[model samples]
Target chain A: MAALILAHHQTSPAERLKDAAAVAFIALLLGIPMIGLLTVDQGGALRIATRWPALFAFVAACFVGRLVLRYALDQWRARQLARDQADTPAKEVSLATNPLLNWIGWVALGVSVALPIVFAENRYVVDTATTVLIYVMLGWGLNVVVGLAGLLDLGYVAFYAVGAYTYGLLSTQFGWGFWSALPVAGAITASFGVLLGWPTLRLRGDYLAIVTLGFGEIIRIILVNWTELSGGPNGIASIPRPSFFGLPFKPPGDDPTFASFFGLEYATHQRIVFLYYLILVLALLTNLFVSRMRRLPIGRAWEAMREDEIACKAMGINARNVKLSAFAIGAMLGGFAGVFFAARQGFISPESFTFSESAIILAIVVLGGMGSQLGVVLASLVLVLLPELGRDFAEYRMLLFGAAMILIMIWKPGGILSHREPTLRYFANGGRR
Target chain B: MTAPAPLLSVEHLTMRFGGLLAIDDLSLDVAARKITGVIGPNGAGKTTFFNCLTGFYKPTIGSVRLNHPQRGVLRLEALASHQVARSAQVVRTFQNIRLFPQMTVLENLIVAQHNALQHASRFSLAGLLGLPAYRRAEAAAMAKAVGWLERLKLIEKADTPAGALPYGMQRRIEIARALCVDPLLLCLDEPAAGLNPRESAELNELLKHLSRDEGIAILLIEHDMSVVMNVSDHLCVLNYGRKIAEGTPAQIQKDPNVIKAYLGEEDADEMRADELRADEAIDQEAVR
Candidate 1:
């Protein structure tokens, strides 16, 4: 019986490996499209003709690679389990608990935080780090809904848009500074979240996904159509940049620019660095917030709802309230990220808040191991940063990314770093700081 | 005996699903600290009665008044299943085990205690930031879960997924989960249906312990005659959605209506002969 259970649980590893291989193969096959995009003539017909074989090859490679990887991983896991059992005569092995794992996790986090500060000095590197941080924050926020609550949300980017538009319109329309507009954006977005959640609380699974998808589309459509408010497709440009106590990012002089006030040159690197740290702080705050929530009773209730709605009801949990809170909280965090995004870009546009952006964020949460903060961050780093870092693979980049996501799902259906069970803890008594 | 005002009182509970009458004016009292057995042939509205009690299905015409200790008298008929659980403290176990398969045995119990264990800080940003109160509650819940596991003789399997447990063990865990709620009333549906003789005996002991020692009202729907006859302090027999008889175990055993309802007159003769043969075999086994 034990062997059977082990076999059943372990089958996923093999399946995942096969999926990963197939995805890699597909990337190779789709590499032709990237080549075509780069090499094809300006004429549309010529581009299509040149891209066909490359697309076919990419598809074939992905299929074959997936099959081979699956077979290999299955065989490997089986043998490893057998060997481990043989070597250790006793079946029971003492496993370390959460405290020790948490300690190690904190140390690893500290190292990750310090790495770029110590080694990366380039402005572009800093900019990339900041982008990864923004995604990390978004991933953590979405994790609360999709990971902890097990609700699949596809329009997460809408909240992001809400925050950006809130900050952008308020700052540009009135003379409100970045700091003042930030809270307004978050509040407005959270209210929108509640509005969206109210109508869709009864929906579950695929239905919820479709509604969220529609919600995202609606947000984008309204942003594009409402020229009076959003400045239309031309977007809100030349937005005010963030200031350090009324000092602008310019050379030190009577003008009180950032460079002159700080007694330094007005290098663009200064702005990038400041933005990087700002996003880093926001992302850290997101992680802290999600972590605390997971330990709270409401958090456990969310997990309970995710596991089984019927049983959750039997336990006296208000499913509607729990889901509403998740949606509201998730949207609030997305709004915070959006405000930061507006500040960082100094501009806003409907084009930035598309369905694909929502898909990518959802993919980050799914790949990271739903409900795992570290997993979300790691997934975001790989998904967001990897493509940018591998610009040479630009043509095949999106194809590779999509394939990688599919393979990851196949490999680790639960998530790459999902908790074995929903974390059940009460944060009401001042346990978390 | 003061009788405690009958924790759950039903009056003319009738439920109709389209043309088929699932339950017809079935009335029964679930007194405090008593084991009430509901027994009938298959599809005899046993589960439907449990559903009405738990607020899973609203009776077409009836009143289920639960005198709650904390939340004053509640009309269970108007409440949703979750509302009934929260307000009236009514908990139930399904016929087929419904444990979250991927969750651990400990998690199953913790989930059961979710309501009581929730803290106010759960809604705060501090709770979202992983506060110590949340950690302590988690620890307390785990400790309680371990205790429940020990009582169920499932301590060793605490870490194992609920779905990985044996069929009999899973049923026991389901009962244990319901116990975690510290419920005022527990309604179990066909708990003994799939258990073997030995497992059934264990279940009987547990059920007896719950009613006798815990001071909890237990209303169970079972088709297992031996279990129904042995453990019931009070027995209500139903046929075609109508109550045929209600009395003590001995009285229910001799009730001619019950015997006739369970077995038709023509089949009773054949069943009696078979019972006699079975009795002889038991005697022979005892002698051996």
Candidate 2:
């Protein structure tokens, strides 16, 4: 149908010329004041100077450029018409279910595992990679709620803050280690998830988002005002780092440390490298867990509820339970990521768990495509690496990042990977029924 | 009501929506192992009745009792929407065809059996661990979905998204999905609205097979006369949220109240004239 319209609306050469002439006239009208007339500083006095030649050249360039651009567009459309006519009718295949995407996932996994080893000496590179993985894990967590369950959560960082504070306070006040604190933090965060989800389960769309946004801010405000518990904006510092199975990665002390037990020289970079590998494993486990859950009955229910809540209720699915489960599980994952963040940085404050952090995490999930596990990896890389790569363009970093995001959204409105895959197929062995 | 007993009975069902009375104090019985057609004009409250029975809306003053074979008598109106299907074994399809558009035909069917799978999976713990019990339950669900797809002649499109299928196929898919719920009483809303004559005929056969052979009671709310009149063992006509008439299809067709409700006062006169002309033509042919 679109091709038919394109084919029928072929403009005549006379009309094309007239179109270019009208564009040039408008350009001249605007260019006269801005380009033709310029204010020049004449030795402490300002004077209006005329640059008619430059202005005419600019207008002439616009006219020619418009004509060429139109001609090129017409030619492209004509080619598209020809191709569309000759081609077979396109069948709607699930684009995301391609075997090639699975292969890409495997290849990405391989590279992520080998990255720290290959760049062992470059702490900067490994550090940046670790950041990317952290975001990837958070993206997967948010994907469960926003992507699979279709809940627009604007305050996911609240869970992250809860997880971090759970660990920070436990370790700082109670002398708890990372291993023991991890589960406690995750459980607490999951409970918090349910707490927030209970009241907002009846709300949906924009209202739910607003409540979540306020939830995030409320957590931050609590963390700030409750100085006795949270250490206020001054933040908790010198939090204990995780060890290698009771073996601390410290300079060979009286006790056998990680380096001493291995009979190798101790280096500060050892801990950084260990942190990178630790996060890598955590992110992979998160990926496996999320992907496995996607195939489970609850996961399918989540996706179904996302598609249509009323239909889900009609299908005998308890809408409240499905939504609450999604929130709890998603928050649990986010909390786990938060625990790791606190351990790695060895410090955390309300300033660190801001709304912008939630926005960036949500952005990664959306930009990756809702419910696509592999897309999260790609999106996290783009989101994290863009800023790191833009460090040299200091002043323009934010400007470029905004522009890139806009371009991506315009190019793929449904996210980078929009198509959905069925959780279960009748043909498990890839044969038709 | 030839069956041993009616599967579902409604008493004094009334639904008021703000200033509008969607369903008045209406009552009807649907017999087991038979197709009971609820025929009514637009805004006659047929859908409102289905909604009330399905627990989508709380009746102002009424009772919806479902006589479950195993679970004894169940009060449907008091239960929530999901409980209506889960415990009472009463499921319904929507008039506007609400389907998970992104899910495959098989997935949609499988979702209908979520309660069973969820239980066997032990609320997803066993499924997450990939236990044998969960696997068995999942495989059984897959088998059930596949069976319905094959029976509905939708096996070839099982992998296709439900929304992408043609209107006729989507209607069948909806029925196939609803069947997966293992409902004792299936209420279908306008199942033949978008179907062609041939498809409608196929639907008639399917509905009969389901009610008579499968022994599942079907309460069909349809606007297609050819479908409702041909397949319904019993018919109930509703007008202005009131039960105007109830009898066999043959008797209800000749009911004066049903005719007057269907064709207003003036249209009934025109319909009588048309019927008279048709009778005269048949008489002339007999003379020849």
Best prediction by lDDT: 2
Minimum summed lDDT over a 10-residue window in model 2 chain B is located at B274-283
Query: Chain A vs. true chain A, TM-score per candidate?
Result: 0.79, 0.86
List the global CA lDDT of all models: 0.80, 0.90
Model 2: share of true interface contacts reproduced: 0.73
Candidate 2 lDDT over B1-288, as tens digits, reads: 455767899998989989888888888889888899999999999999999998889898899898998999999999999999899889899999999989988899999999999999897889989999999999899999999999999998887788888999989999999999998999999999889999999999999999989989999999999999899999999988889999888677767688789877888776877756665675676589
* Candidate 1 Cα outliers beyond 4 Å, as residue runs: A1-108, A115-121, A245-248, A253-258, A421-433, B1-5, B69-72, B119-122, B125-150, B155-161, B272-288
lDDT of 2 by residue, A197-275 (tens): 9999999999999999999999999999999899999889989999999899888889999999999999989999899
- Alpha carbon lDDT at A318, candidate 1: 82
How does candidate 1 fare on TM-score? Answer: 0.82
Per-residue lDDT for A1-433 in model 1, tens only?
1222134344465666565565766576557557434554665554434566666666676667665655665787789888998888675423224564477568857865775576456767777777888888999999888988888999999999999998888888897888888878888999999988999988999999999999999999999999999999978987788877777775555787878776786787777777777787778878877777775677767776887887888777788888998999999999999998988898889999999999989989888887888788778878987688668897988788777776777678877776553353222122421
lDDT of model 2 at position A306:
90
- Tens digits of per-residue lDDT, candidate 1, B1-288, equal 655588788999999999999899888888888899999888889988888888789899999998887888899999998888777888999997778776667778887877666653555544455468766766777777777778889876776667777899999898888888878898988899789999999889888998989888899899887788888889998888999999887667656677778888777666767766765676676589
